[model samples]
Target: MGIQYFSQVLIFGSFIGLLGWTITNQVGRTQLQVKSREDWLLDGTGLTIQGILIPLLQATLVYWLYQYLLPIQQGYLKLPLILAFVISFVVIDYLYYWNHRLLHTKLLWKVHQVHHTVTQMDVLGTSRNTLWTSLLIVYLWIHTLFLYLLADPTGYLLGVSLTSTLDLWRHSRLIIPANTKLYQFLSPWLILPQDHAWHHCCKIHNYNYGANLKIWDKLHGTYYKSKNMPSIIGIPSSLNLFQKLFFPFS
Candidate 1:
């Protein structure tokens, strides 16, 4: 719901490692291709002002709007608290999947392209979209409605943070540990790095748009389900500095 508390940060960090380890063990090793220093940072200095500011600002704004504009207690859905929390996550991920696909659309690519332009995959790559492109998903509106109707503020933020943590790890280059049977069971739904690396690969063959789950992609035609074939990563063309800087408007 806000900047992470220390305990939340610690918990989230542990979760991040869990996700990274899963990917490193399972799918990432097979995709082992060396990336250049330039590739590491969008060809150099990868963390743009926009990239850094967008998520922080948007999270703040959206959380605030949800808390105030759509206060909870507006209605009761009659679902149990736990069920409401679970349902909220599904709804949020569902909206995000479509919004993510929309960014890949031709008309919107000029803005969204800044993110896909990165040739490397990592935790940071998850937040690489243009601010406007990220904003288009309207996650807050979904949160607001859910909070107002069914979830409490704490539960809603917990759901969002859980989803965010999942997204962060899936974008990383880590693979799941092959030795563990438990990893295998968790890997499929959790969006491991190998799963998302395919999404970042060139030609965008698999797409794999969901952050928290694979259901949306599978349900829609965008799901790419395979571990055998590899995808080429990055955008078709690189944008110059000015182009990236002006991406939201372009």
Candidate 2:
């Protein structure tokens, strides 16, 4: 319970902090000012749904479903702290790599395309997607499943919080210098802002689908190596507000 509380604080606090930073920074301010009302509607709705409603649904409905299905196995998996962290940060990351790739496929692209509509790297646009898109994301189910199974979920919850925090950071314009030692160390393993920017690029959206790590994409040959930000980001979308919020498909 304590760890869960801490994780919630970490994730929400990061969002608030990033949001404040974005609004205050000159470039971020300009980006926000140029946004259309429809963009705000989509991004605002998406953030509310993904940050609040979806989490509530995950905590209640999905967690309850798991409890019913595995009543006898509640808290059965007692892994070491490091192993549990690895499962969430490494193992599940691999799974999400494929899951993300799957969303890009023709069948699921409509559902996921809303997320790619952001024209720039902004934390506010990170969760922009159709309302029901959360249902297709593996994190909604898998994270709850692991939380239900782990007797001591401290490490796993830490990984989850860190991943959520990084997700926000990578989507924002708060990029680290590539020549810095920090970037040098993290770039080889983690997905940096520039790396994810290319993923949302209008030109090369097919590559860099990994969430937490680049190794998955590198191993699978989907990694797009770029030291600079993409010239053009986001695909053009003609969907109206209603279409974007509910059904993004044409």
TM per candidate: 0.71, 0.97
Model 2 residue 65 CA deviation in Å: 0.5
Q: After superposition, how far is residue 68 of candidate 2 from its true place, in Å?
A: 1.5
Candidate 2 TM-score to native:
0.97
Q: Show the colliding residue pairs in model 2.
A: none
Cα lDDT tens digits, model 2, 1-250, are 7888998899999999998999999998999999999899899998899889988987899999998999988899999999999999999999999999999999989878889999988999989999888898889999999999999989999999999999999999898898899988899989998999999998899999998999999999999998889888899988877888887543
Regions more than 4 Å wrong, model 2:
248-250
- Candidate of highest TM-score: 2
Q: Summarize candidate 1's per-residue lDDT along 161-213 as a digit string, tens digits.
A: 67766666666655566557866797667666677777877765348888888
lDDT of each: 0.61, 0.91
Total clashing pairs for each candidate: 16, 0
